[model samples]
Target: MKKSDLALGIFLLSAIIFMIIPMPAALLDILLALNISIALIILLNALFSQEALNMSSFPSILLFTTLFRISLNISSTKLILTTGAPGNVVTTFGNFVGGGDLIVGIIVYIVLIIIQFIVINKGSERVAEVTARFTLDAMPGKQMAIDADLNTGAITDVQARERREKIQEESSFFGAMDGATKYVKGDATAGLVITFINFIGGIAIGMFRQGLGFNEALDRYTILTIGDGLVSQIPSLMISLATGILVTKVSKEADMGDILVKQLFSIPKVLYMVGAAMIFLGITTPLNVVVFSAYGLLFIISGRVIANRIEIAGIEEEVNTDESSADEIRRPENVTSLLQVDPIELEFGYGIIPLADTNQGGDLLDRVVMIRRQVALELGCVVPMIRLRDNIQLKPNQYVIKIKGTPVSEGEILFDHYMAMNPGYVEEEITGIPTFEPSFHLPAIWITESQRERAESLGYTVVDPPSIIATHLTEVIRNNLGELLTRQDVQNLINNVQESNSTLISELIPKLLGIGEVQKVLQNLLKEGISIRDLITILETLADFASTTRDTDVLTEYVRQSLKRAISNKYFPDSETTSVVTLDPKIEQEIMGSVKQTEQGTYLTLDPEKTQDIIHSVGEEVSKLENLGKNPIIITSPIVRMYFKKLTSDYYKDLIVISYNEIESDVELQSVGMVTA
Candidate 1:
């Protein structure tokens, strides 16, 4: 479309003509030399052109050209050598090539020409795709931020992909090709340069044979080489030099060895043999062998040994460098200052946050914190003060001071009521009656004595700050609050909190928000504490959820929610009693037959039909919970019973439902139990 592209087209057509035409032998050689010359020029301009080089296309173009030419020359040379042509001519050029015979040459030429044309046609698009991929992979810590948004509901995959495409399109073209061409062109061109020089020398010999003396030679011609080795190599040498220089300059920050290695293989295998050609010629001439030997040594040093060293050094340097501020910003900071205490140490319980706006679950903490914050907002508390100070003391005995009620203070009642809701609380674990752990462990922070009294009167106690509170709080907040806060919610809650455009947290909001402490604990247990056998059980649970279910994501949520509740209470009663697992009649018979009874209960290996049927029912139960979305819905024995009863009831006559409850716990009905669906 542009002038440069048009020129390249013309050069390609000229090359096709040179390969295809049946011109006089001398004229054909001259045309081949000219064609090579023009190709070098076009390729150089393509490399340095203001018009961007689509690198993805460039390789195929180079490959097609190099292969096509070598095949053509070799085939044509063989034909000419085998024919009754002069032995001198056969020796000079090696053999016939291209269409070794007219018919073969035409077939080869047409096929090569078509392939070359197709490469050119598709080159631009290929470059675009490659550039796009490179931009994504090579971009720095920024990608993590991008991923955060992707995990959250902030950005869609299509949007992220589109942004990446746009960035690739805008980046500099030659900038991308720097390291690639260095080694490939290096070997190819070195051999080419030597050949061109030899051709020049050969042409001089030709002129001398025609009876021109030294003075006459100077007068007759300015550049005498027509078909010398030097002439042949000219194109390759220029291309190689261009590649090396561009690579060195543009990719200065890139590893030198990596660039060189890329170039080394890019040089054709035929080119190596061409370098060796000098040694063959040197058997007859003085300098031929010496020149080839030096060339080979140079290629070995620059293209292999030194290149590797440079790359290794560059990698080491990168390894030693400190992570940039951008990286730091992407990672969450453990801001465990006094005011922002760990929720875990606060004796606060975990709850799932719902993102009604998005399919992903939100952090329950953000909602709770938001409601608490509303108290602040409504009271015109422009700023809530939080401070961390060192080494403050409180009377340990005074922690259990009496509440100010007629019988029990309002503060004590609230504390008791809150503790009552916590299924994890065990009365035997407590030392004193009505003692509530002080949720906050603040030091002397210039608070009025009256403020302290008010806090204590509310049944709060002061104690030494817990060491693990920071990490614990961050985990709780991150798991509980991270998902529920939309950009709008964030903007409203905190005044001018800095935001990142490419945070992965913002991107995959739903998935991140959906994570719970139970899941985190399960992962840790599997990673560090669980036995291989128990690990297999966990994996089996995941696999069942994955293969039999429509969405593993939902099933995982359900399992996590159930696990969270169970672990918090230090009990798995729900899992023990009201399991969603339905034992087949055949499985029940097998278990009964085996009857390996323990003090607590019986255990038996399940059969194939039983396993399959259980797996099927589990999937159906999970599928029926499509209404729950990403959040796991808790199912109790009562709930399961009610569901079955409703299914058969006349109240839901129009709807189809199934009853399945062959499993029940041995524990009393009041004992909380878990059942992962």
Candidate 2:
């Protein structure tokens, strides 16, 4: 065992030994003195320390010391009643405390008891209780503040973690102290009981066994008992004072002594007024002229000195401020920090600020947090922190969502109004300001609070401003998640999978595929609105086919076939036949015929006229499905699926294309249209 651990264990063990074993006078003296020293050390430490967390172990220390002190009390009581003389420390303490009179010593002990019990212990207990409760109550606000700082780029993840840990430590410290204060109070009570027992027991033993008269016994044992009581209570009093100082301390900065002095005496005006009052009292009243007038003169002089110092300090501060400002203007700009960009940003105007501010009862910031979580759960990827900024150039209630510092979408709202969109079944039109829904550009109307209930009753979809922004932001993130997936993110995903299936990641990465290659395949999946949360299955599929071809596109195709069950469930439900389109075999063969391969990858070199004709036919087929109110899905041979998706992506952003190999047999399908050129 380490030396410190062994020493602490032995220290605790000694407390038990003290209660069990008999001790000589010399050893008892040394132990009593040591106990006094321990109490003094605790008092001084608590008095000077800056933060309450600095004494986080104080609760455990309180328990240990209380047990030890009670043991010492037991020892001293034994010697006082049995031997009538514990040690010179006790004998000398008795004489000094009694002042050769038992009554005086008794009165002094009673006062000490009152001060330690009713004043210090009681007050400390209440303060610790209230402080612990307050700390617990304020914890959530503090955590939210930390998260705000993190989201705004004011602090990094590491710094946020440290701050959160500090908050936890503080709450725990105060809570433990709340319960620990009772130990100090109980110790005082125990001291009172032990002291009474010693005095009564000592008097009886002295009179009966030592053959002393009643008065003589009273004089000897009363003084001795009082001495023992004083010895124990003085240390307990110091400890009690320490507890009060620690729990009552409010600030976490600098020494307690420094804060107390500055806060109490730093105001020169108060000092000057007090000095004037002293002078007035000395001159006007019949008070002692020398004593009171001397005090007033001293205060006036001190005030003058302090005021002069303050003036000089203010002038120096002004000079320093001027110098700092000049230096700041002359220095070269630090633009490195400005070079970085947020992955996702929501910039809004001042009129919308109230929606993001907690004090204004706005839950926009909370919605943003939920958006990140929702995206993660739906897409199986952790979204980067969305930074919210306020832009002044925009109109009131206008906001924009940006990807990598470039605005991609913008919206405006009327305060205290809800957006109502017709779901094609709401025949009765509500009278309101016409606008387009920012998310999908569908026609919507802004309705006031009174119109909201009626609009909902009329089968119109009603949403508040925050919900609109949150939905729009969610769509933007879903669209851009492919571009936002970095190699580092891929590595993190690999590490997560490696925790369970190490061999698969090890064989796939840096062998048949690099991180960027895996990132591309994952991005490809994400770009098509596929949830990559089933990472193990995805990696296992890659591991199976990655060796034959390092081409991520080809590998992604194979992985898709492996996840065909999920894809089938997503697009075609077994309960009903899904309407879809099928590519003509002749055009599929023609597409394959034009395909050319190079060192880079495969590309189609079909005639532009032919490509245009095929695209037009596909668009006609897609419109037919749209007219039928069915999703535009086209099935092709497994070899031509990826190329067909690439060709149609520019024309249709939300179209879904699947291969015959990517569908399950149990899924019912009906071809309502065909694409041909």
Candidate 3:
């Protein structure tokens, strides 16, 4: 065992022994001094600690000290009654410190007990109880705040976990303290009872056993009893004061002394007013002029010194700030910071600032938080934290969305206007400024609030400026989710899955496919706008087919077929015969025949002219489906699906490509056109 642990064990065992055994006078004196020293140390530590949690073990310490002190009180009582003396420490305290008068000593001891029991102990107990109650009641809110920060990417998982742990510690500390305080109260009561018994029992024993008269007995035992009470009560008072200090501490991030000094004495004006008031009182009142004048002048001088120090500190702070800026320029380590880049950033100009600022009644931040949740649910991927910044170079209304520190999309919005787009049935064109929807590039118009109601009545879809930005941002993130799916992100998903399906994760990860390979498969699925939310099915499929091939594209195809139910529900509406274009059997054969396999992966080795012819034919068939007001979905044989999708990916970014195996058998589909080259 550790020496400290063994020492504590011995100390507790000694307390138990002190209660039952007849301790020697010298040993009693030594233990009494030790008790006082411990209480003083606890008081000072509690007074200076930055926060209550710094002394989380104080509740248990309170219990130990109370028991030890009570045992010493009993030991001292026994010595005083039977031996007619306790020790030099107690006798000296009875004679010198108590003024050698029985009434004076009794009065002093009574005041200490009253102060501890009625004032300090009572207040500490109440504060501890309330603090525990408040901490427990606020736990849910604190938990929610942590979750909000985690969701918005303001804090990492580790940081959130640490915050949660700190909160739990605080709750437990206060709750235990609420009960521990009762030990202090009970100790005080027990000491009062012990003191009474010592006086009564000592006087009776002296008169009857030692044959001393009432006056001599009263005088002798009264002083010793009062001395013993003072010895015990002083340490108890210190502990009570310590408990009060701990429960009342407010600041946890700085030194308690510093915080108190800053709050009480930092302002020179308050000190100056006090100095003037003291001087006025000294002159006008019947107070001692010399003593009051000395205090007044001291205060005024201190105030002036404090004012000058404040000014000097401010000057020094400014100088340090300037020096730091210059040092940053001179420092080579600055380059390291510049190399870091945000995964996603949104830069806007001044006009749209109100939409992003909550103080200006903007819900842009709330919308951004929701966008992350929306994407997580829709795509089963975490979007990197989106940083919002303002750029003075752009027009007031313009904003840019960047991925990996490079601008990919920019839009301009009228802060006071709403965006109205025709759903194609609205014939009444509103008089407004012409614009295009930022997310889809469909023709839209900027309309004022006055026109919004009329536009909606005319079957035109109207959206506010904040909604427009959020929608555009969501679309950009969704489209680029594949690129955003980092290896770390893949590992996070696997860890989450491992929490429940540990066997599947351990077998598939590192055994068959590595994180990078799994990331590639997930990225491929995301690129095709597939949801990997059902990770179990995805992992199970990968583990099944992984031994045959580690090629990510082929694994992704298998995973997609496993997720066919979700895909069918997503693309093909229930009980509806969806119109889709089909790959011509002849063209599928040609594409399969042109396929080339290498160690790296497979690629289409079709003739350049033939590829162009096939691309043109795919576009023609896609347009036919588009004109039919249907999504441009192309169904192909399972084997040729991935290659065909890759062949057309460059030409059509939003094209929906599926295979025959991925479609549900219950779902109906009609092929309106065929891609043939």
C-alpha lDDT of all candidate models, in order:
0.37, 0.91, 0.92
RMSD each, Å: 23.8, 11.2, 8.7
Q: Residue 518 lDDT in model 3?
A: 89
The regions of model 3 sitting more than 4 angstroms off are: 1-289
**Is candidate 1 or 2 superior in lDDT?**
2
- Over 4 Å off, model 1: 1-13, 20-53, 63-151, 160-227, 241-677
Top-TM-score structure, candidate number: 3
Residue lDDT tens for model 3, 551-576:
88988989989999999999986798
Q: Give one digit per residue, the lDDT tens place, for model 1 in 534-632.
A: 222333344345445323233433343333432222232343332222323443344346444455433444455654554455345444443332212
Ranking by lDDT: 3, 2, 1
TM-score per model over all chains = 0.26, 0.59, 0.66
Number of clashing pairs per prediction, in order:
56, 0, 0
Q: Using TM-score as the measure, what is the rank order of every candidate, best first?
A: 3, 2, 1
Tell me the lDDT of model 1 at 409: 10
Q: Give the per-residue lDDT digits (tens) of candidate 2, residues 218-281.
A: 9999888888888889999999999999998888778888898778767788877887888788
Cα lDDT of model 3 overall?
Answer: 0.92
User: What lDDT score goes with residue 300 in model 2?
Assistant: 72
Q: Which clashing pairs does model 3 show?
A: none
